[model samples]
Target: MLNTKKLLALTLTLLFVFALIPAAAQAAPVYRTLDEIKADGTINIGVFSDKNPFGYVDENGEYQGYDVYFAERIGKDLGVKINYVSTEAANRVEYLETGKVDIILANFTVTPERAEKVDFALPYMNVALGVVSPDSRVITDLSELSADDPVIVISGTTAETYLIANNPEVKLQKYDTYANAKNALENGNGVAWANDNTEVIAFALQNAGYTVGIPSLGSQDTIAPAVSKGNDTLLQWLNDEIVSLADEQFFHKDYEATLAETYGLDYEDSLVVEGGAVNAK
Candidate 1:
């Protein structure tokens, strides 16, 4: 009887200890603040590796794009080395929520649905959904699309949400990355390719056989950096950075340097979001 009681007590004690252990072991991921990142001397910025004119790796294996230009400035001002983490549109929120990235510079659009998951910094660029198609045929009406004629869309983008809600019957050939979507469009996999207007406009401008038939669709939106929700220190620092950079016309300068070659000088005024102020300060 004594032995059995001792064994039972030991089991209860072990069970109690384990019950408390999980509380510590399964603690939520803690995100690093500006100070912590400064101390480490590196900021992990998540960016798309396959989206050209916004974010992509060049033939020489170097990161180059409009968003990357802004990220480079952020690193230079913060006095930290940039550790660029190649990310996809779908994995952006996961990167922030899981503490895998200090900031997301992957052309993240500010939306109420996304703001609930991650804190978005002030606007840095203007954007809207647009559709591009082969010059032979332009799709202006969503009603024209059917299962026989699909639309190429990148996963986890506003384009996906807009189509599903507005035109559910339109068949979607979803790609996890933008490069694949571009390929599918070129290969005649879909009737039209939908994405950010800025990106689609760039595509139409640079590529020969495509044209942006629908230049603007859905609501006008802005692109901004995103940090882990509740990370106020980092958020404030980024906001301050934006305001400070505005004095120098930094974003316009970034456009001139990286995007203007593809988009030309005519687009400078409409696209550039100076000092993180979407409107008046």
Candidate 2:
């Protein structure tokens, strides 16, 4: 019912809008597999940039941590150049689902709900929730925390989920990164920071005047590599890699190389996961 020029203009506007749709949105979903990834000769791996001892960048600007060490070995065995992608805990699943990275080695904990989203390859480390607070007044009990004196937890971590699910009344001050949460804890933002026991223990070890009062707060779990869902070829390769590495006592070597300084010989036997199982090295 419009004039020729107006009708033409309206049709062109519609065409332009359609053309502006992102190619990714318009095309069928593309899932990357092992062969396709290998053909590219570079594997993108996601790891935390701020979490220390487990995954972090050193002063020399080189990424160094237990998970990063394991990721380096995967690149070597696969004969591919490794591309390190710095990821946050909250974005670990997103990075895999969107193909931003081929593998997540950022100390990803295996949980049934998370398993539904990404395929966990094999466990390389064992972890459980622990709380750290100022040595002056350690927080050993969760009931001690109130709304005004809450606990700090990293968003998208098992600690947050566990607390929210099991203890709905527990108040939480959630942060996106470990560094931020650590700073908050130091600045008296919360009574304590609840995180992986290894991380908290490392923190207490590295810094004075802080201690892990609650060394083991939640259920024990395993840390493993995660690939995009339905990535069977990649998952199988990773599982095989885990077994092959175990035959060499590689996880023990990994602990010696990365985790030893923080935990020492005392925890060496209790924390390492060998051959995809929770076995002390």
Candidate 3:
């Protein structure tokens, strides 16, 4: 009933529609599975290059820190080499979503909001907010701050989110990197710096003339590794890896090797979470 030319046109339209189906399916973000990563012989990990005692680069240009130590162990266990990718606090999610890095170990805190975007492994560390300011005029309380006195916070961090949600009246000076936030505090760009208690405590210990006026703020939280959303294979592997490492007391060893020099032995029990058991003795 159809002319030859009409039939030809209809066939071409069907082919065009079918061609778009595969292209559309491929357009979604792709993540490597555990088997695929093993096949690749190298797993890319995202970490901060400036956050010391957690994730940073040494003068020798080698990546070194608590997170880096864990990353190294992951690589060794997976029988793969590691490719470290420097990531900032704000870009951690993007790195995972785009497959730029297979895992994020940059002191990433587990939050319900982040959980929606990335799959978080079991916790490896505990954390809370703290404020550090010059000893000359310590800010012991957020209420002590004047409306004009800005608090320094790193963008995309829980500190920023907490302050914004809890104390919207307080002014904030947001920086993109830990180094810049530290510089701003040193240069008196803000009245105080708000960040993870571990970091502010480390700062107060390492540098002179600064004190953590409020040593603990907000609810206690846990830090964990994160992978792309729906990457259940890697997520399960990381969870199992963490649990297996507990038998050997791996996280405690990690803290002693990297953080004890900064926080001393007093904090080891409080900060380190062994085998993903947050409340384990």
Candidate 4:
């Protein structure tokens, strides 16, 4: 027994609620399948433009690095061109989740927390945490750092997570980009910079008067490509491709071509993980 005006208001409210359902459904993460990517003729890959020897834009403006080499092979094998999307450490997962990029190759370390958000492909490289500081007062151990001496870390990295979890006494200077973190260290913003061992080692080698005092700080981890959650078709294809690439020792060659100068042959067998088979250490 409702009046005309009251009935009209009720009907409008129902319509409004119904209208929002489709929009809510559309807001869920969208994943493009492998076939769709191939049909598009191009795959978007997210990589760090500033993280050299891993993923970076060279002086010539070409994307060159270990991860870039692997990305090139993926594109070739898929019969598609690549569109490199510059990304930062903090935005890697967002890029995949939002469908902004089909794959993330930005030195993404595989961690349990990240695996729950984005589906990780097989690992291509092994990694660990390291700390680099000025040669004047090398920080060989976390114990050497005073409570006032802050450590530099990149946001959304394992280094930041580890320190936050393990060393509540230590202060941290967080940056969004690897370049900024390096600059912060050079500017003496922090006493030490904690990051991936590969990156810190490269920094010490390239920049004079810096030493990787705490090489191998945390547990060993692996670097892998990541796709949006529920992108099963692409995930499966990547796994298959990784295994297929093992026949030619593709990852080892990638290290030789891109990482050898920085890491040298001694790191070859240790860092390279062919066929995505990570032997239990």
Candidate 5:
């Protein structure tokens, strides 16, 4: 019913449109790299806004914590401005994956499951699981805790997972951050608070009425700076920086300066990371 010349022209147009579709679909979205951050004169770092002794804002509304100290140094070394993004334990990885932060300096533990999602540099700190209870009535053994007694832990943390997988009967009262869980424990909301041993030890030492019963749980692991997956350039830069710090025992100095007063005993060798440290071994 159509003219031959007109049908031929329409067919050619359809073919041309189909060819352009593949080209458009094949176009890749531009992703900024670590080098781009340096060129832009600003590096955004993600940190926990409420997690104390690690990352928090002081009375003056200025960020201050062990992690903040490290972030400042990274910015200084890079000769760029530092922008802080307040994050939570659960959101740290999402921040990196979405390019919301160039690096996550928050207290992110290295795990096999998480390693698949992001790249981790050499460890700057070491940690294990621990449980905390009131000094007046501390729990020394896993069997000591009552089946009815609810244990407070941050949701999605290793603490919750460890108890769920290992101790089936233990009741868990999960919160989202250290501050909330600390408050719950202070109010006698739970029988105990379980988390990274480093946090529990610090809390017990700083607050007079609390004590850490389980000093170590599970395997020893390291905390490292994390970047988005496939971000080898940024990961390499962080690794190099960490290695350089190891050579001078920078984290040792960091612990003495920031955490020593919180942890009464001399724990330099236990908590600090020395030069030539590697986790792959």
Candidate 6:
């Protein structure tokens, strides 16, 4: 129906667009796990960079801590280079969900709420709530805190939940991270700091005038690695790794190597998890 030149031009245009249709269809999906890692050749790991003796940067600008040690091992096992992503407590899940990190070894505590969003691997460490106050005036009992005085807690932590549900009389001054909560209590911003027993004990021992009271509060909880939701492949792999590591009592070894100097002998049993259970070293 057209002249030779016009008909040829129209046919070529149609062929060109048709060619692009197949190319577009052949392109892979954006959020693929295996292909993404294969392309990057590195497994990104998320960890806390401020919470010392667990995950922190040292003097040499190297990420050094208990979690870092494990992250290195994971990278080795995965046959991929380790790309460390420094993250906060609140940002850990976000990092995983956003694909910023393949795994989280950030001392993340396993909870039912978090599990709904992300899959938690088998626990490698045990933890519970504890309170730390000035040595001169320890708060052993919740009743000791005045109605006017608020406790310091890191937001999005078990500490905040525990205090809100259990101690309605006590007000809370919430910070976003462990470093801020520790600093606030150190500066006498609050009468006491409530958080993980391991953190509280470590803080008390690190600073001179503070001591941990109520060394254990609530049921024992396990801290574990977490991966994005629906990531059954990664989740299963992590759980298997945890189980294998537990058989060797690797977590106890991790505790002695990384945490013992900070906490001393008294906390060995309270903080370590071995063979799918909390054990004394």
- For model 1, the superposed segments whose C-alpha errors exceed 4 Å read 1-27, 279-281
Q: What is the C-alpha lDDT of each candidate?
A: 0.89, 0.88, 0.94, 0.93, 0.82, 0.81
lDDT per residue for candidate 6 within 147-259, as digits (tens), equals 77789998878788778887778989999878788779878899998988988888887889888888988777889888877677777777777778876778778878888
**lDDT, residue 58, candidate 5:** 87
lDDT of 2 by residue, 162-197 (tens): 899987888899999888998999898888898888
Question: Cα lDDT for residue 265, model 6?
Answer: 68
**What lDDT score goes with residue 24 in model 3?**
58
| Residue pairs of candidate 3 with colliding backbone atoms | none
What residue pairs are clashing in model 1?
none
In candidate 5, how many Å is residue 171 off?
1.5
* Candidate 1 per-residue C-alpha lDDT over 1-281 given as tens digits, one digit per residue, 9 for 90 to 100: 99999999999999999999778646675799989999999999999888777889999999999999999989999999999999999999989988899999998999888998899998888888999999999888787676799999999999998889888898898999887888899999899999998888889988998889899998888999999988999999999999998999989988998889888888787888998767532
What lDDT is obtained when candidate 5 is compared to the true structure?
Answer: 0.82
lDDT of 1 at 207: 91
TM-score of 5: 0.84
Judged by whole-model lDDT over C-alpha atoms, candidate 2 comes out at 0.88
Error of 5 at 267 (Å): 1.1
Poorest stretch of ten by lDDT in candidate 4:
23-32
- Higher-lDDT candidate of 1 and 3: 3
Could you report the Cα RMSD, in angstroms, for every candidate shown? 7.6, 6.2, 9.0, 7.0, 10.0, 11.9
**lDDT of residue 220 for candidate 6:** 78
Please identify model 4 stretches exceeding 4 Å from their true place. 1-26
Q: Assess candidate 6 and give its lDDT.
A: 0.81
lDDT of residue 267 for candidate 1: 75
lDDT measured at residue 174 in model 3 versus the true structure, 0 to 100: 96
